[model samples]
Target: MTPSQLRSRIKDENFCKNIISYLENIIKEDLSWINPAFEHLISVSSDMESTIFGSVSNCIEDKENTKHNLSDEDKGEQEYFYSGKM
Candidate 1:
């Protein structure tokens, strides 16, 4: 799948939130090492921003597919939860 599709899938699965949470947890424990990482981040921000924006735009354009993917995933999760298989 395209990068945009992968991003949309991640968003639909709430993967980004989990990843952000994980990153926050890591940074909270090691505040001192964040500077070099933050510096590299700033340097890459511009290029990454365009890629992200493009992916979001693709997601928007294929919103119906994204919605279907999300709904089906939700259904699967719900079924698994109800069946005690989660």
Candidate 2:
């Protein structure tokens, strides 16, 4: 027997955007979410070392992906923060 079709991810750009916005609102409401939009951030640690960030050309260029970018002059990296944003 052979498969009749291929499985795929959600391709609706607008629908996906709505879902993401909904999720973002949920996290911001009850959780300790942090970012430029939040005031819950702590000061950088004294022992924290500088870091070099890698470029995310794919996500930055992909129109279907969430439209946001988070970067710092020092350390690089979260999605829930994606490791860097988090």
Candidate 3:
């Protein structure tokens, strides 16, 4: 189901209680199966985080390299503005 549909269902008191009850039963009886699922979720989350951070780091590096290539006069102007001397 879509996120919006899932959210609407969760808002219903009965559905929420049913889900909680089901999870409790699963935890009590099927914890062995849940362990692999939890591990997979953790691995996927870690991979996504590293990918996002790596992209951001590359963008920042590119911006810094561009700034480094600026002429001395332009660098001085940028420094002056950043130093609140503008």
**Candidate 2 regions with alpha-carbon error over 4 angstroms:** 1-9, 31-86
Report the error of model 1 at residue 44, Å: 1.4
lDDT by residue (1-86, candidate 3, tens digit) is 89999999999999999999999997788457578779989999999999999999998899788997889999888899889977
lDDT comparing candidate 2 with the true structure = 0.46
Give the better candidate number (1 or 3) by TM-score: 3
lDDT of 2 by residue, 1-86 (tens): 12332112235677568778988998779543446444423334322322212134555556235344435522243334446544
Best by lDDT: 3
lDDT winner between 1 and 3, please give it.
Answer: 3
- The most accurate candidate by TM-score is 3
Cα lDDT, all candidates = 0.79, 0.46, 0.90
Model 2: residue 39 alpha-carbon error in angstroms:
22
**Best-to-worst ranking by TM-score:** 3, 1, 2
TM-score of each model, paired residue for residue = 0.26, 0.25, 0.42
True-vs-predicted CA distance for residue 53, candidate 1, Å:
0.6
